[model samples]
Target: MYTLKKSLGQHFLTDESICRRIVASLEAYPSRQLLEVGPGGGALTKYLLELRDIDFKAVEVDDDKVQYLKKTYPAIESRLIHQSFLDMAPPFEGPFTVVGNFPYNISTEIVFRIIEWRAQVQSTVGMFQKEVAQRLAATHGNKVYGVTSVLTQTYFDVEYLFDVPQGAFNPPPKVMSGVLRMTPRAAPLDVASERKLFVLVKTAFNQRRKTLRNAVKSLFSEEELQDDLFNRRAEQLSVAEFATLTFRMR
Candidate 1:
């Protein structure tokens, strides 16, 4: 049996039903140029390969798992990459789907990386800690809303699909798991202004307790943010409101 690796934040998915659900989220795609991040023990990988016309590439950080995957699925030996997902260059052209049962610790970073490569990725379906899932799908007015929510929402239409009980994994995580589906926006609210908006969102959430007037004070003149909308905390503003603030700053 494959053992969970603490250093790698490994928790292999043993539940086949959950695996199918994760894969089903990617059903909208025409080509199956699927990129599976951290395919621990190949549970999801196996299912993905069974699809007609499907081709898969997996990025795995664990050396042992990489070797095992290569040995177990010789057909995909050339496609399994042993490098860290953060370091590996994205293969394939534009608009591929990425799916996985991600490592809990690095899940956020993985999503961020995928966002960076949004030009190549059409959509994403993955499992995350329930708390993180909530944050990804959070709206501007939700208490759980913050930098991640704002940044991700700026680029993708996110959905909190379903919850997986702790018992689903081989070594069940203490927290519940949630599946999230993310599709890139047709056009960003302000595509060229993303950097400024990112900075503004980060600053606002960094001091979430403070009103936007105070949190974003450094980025704008007092006169610019004197509007009534700036009087509320970061959590109180919607994604469009945040975009408005970003445009004003620019």
Candidate 2:
């Protein structure tokens, strides 16, 4: 029997139905070139391969899993990379979609990396800790709303598709998990300098207890602080509002 490795955050999806549903969520996109992160035991990978038109590229950090995947699916050998997803660049070329049962520890980093390559990726369907998925799909004024909510919302139209119960995985995570499908927006609602917005959001949520005005004090001049929008806590502001604040601060 396969064992879940705690160090690698390995929680294999024992439910094939959930795997199929996650893949189905990306049915709108051309799945020819698909990038999967952490394909533990190839549960999801197997279903993705069954899609006739699809070509799969997977980035798996664990050496054992990497070897197993290559040996088990020789057809996808060249497509697999035994490296951390963060180390690889995106736009795996061709018409591509990204799907994975992502490791919870590095989920935020992975999302940000994907956001960096949002221009090339058609869409992304991945699993995340339920709370993180909620935050990514949260609207303004939600208690779980924070930097990730604003930054990701700025680039993608996020949908919290469904919850995967704890029992669905080999070694169940303590909390429930959810799948998120993020399609890039046609045009960002209120475009600000991305770098500035990133910094602004990071600062604002770095200390959630502080009001936006205070949190971003170092980044903005006193004159920039005159706006009423930057006066509230980070959770209280909308993504567009944050974009506007970032633009003004720049």
Top candidate (lDDT): 1
Per-candidate Cα lDDT values, in order, are 0.85, 0.84
Q: RMSD for each model, in Å, please?
A: 1.5, 2.0
Number of the top TM-score candidate: 1
**lDDT at position 135, candidate 1:** 96
Model 2 residue 120 CA deviation (Å) reads 0.9
Which ten contiguous residues of candidate 2 have the minimum total lDDT?
A: 89-98
Please identify model 1 stretches exceeding 4 Å from their true place.
Answer: none
Model 2: runs farther than 4 Å from truth?
A: 1-3, 189-192, 207-210
Screening candidate 1 with a backbone cut-off below 3 angstroms (N, C-alpha, C), the clashing residue pairs are none
Q: After best superposition, candidate 2 residue 128: deviation in angstroms?
A: 0.8
Worst 10 residues of 1 by lDDT: 185-194
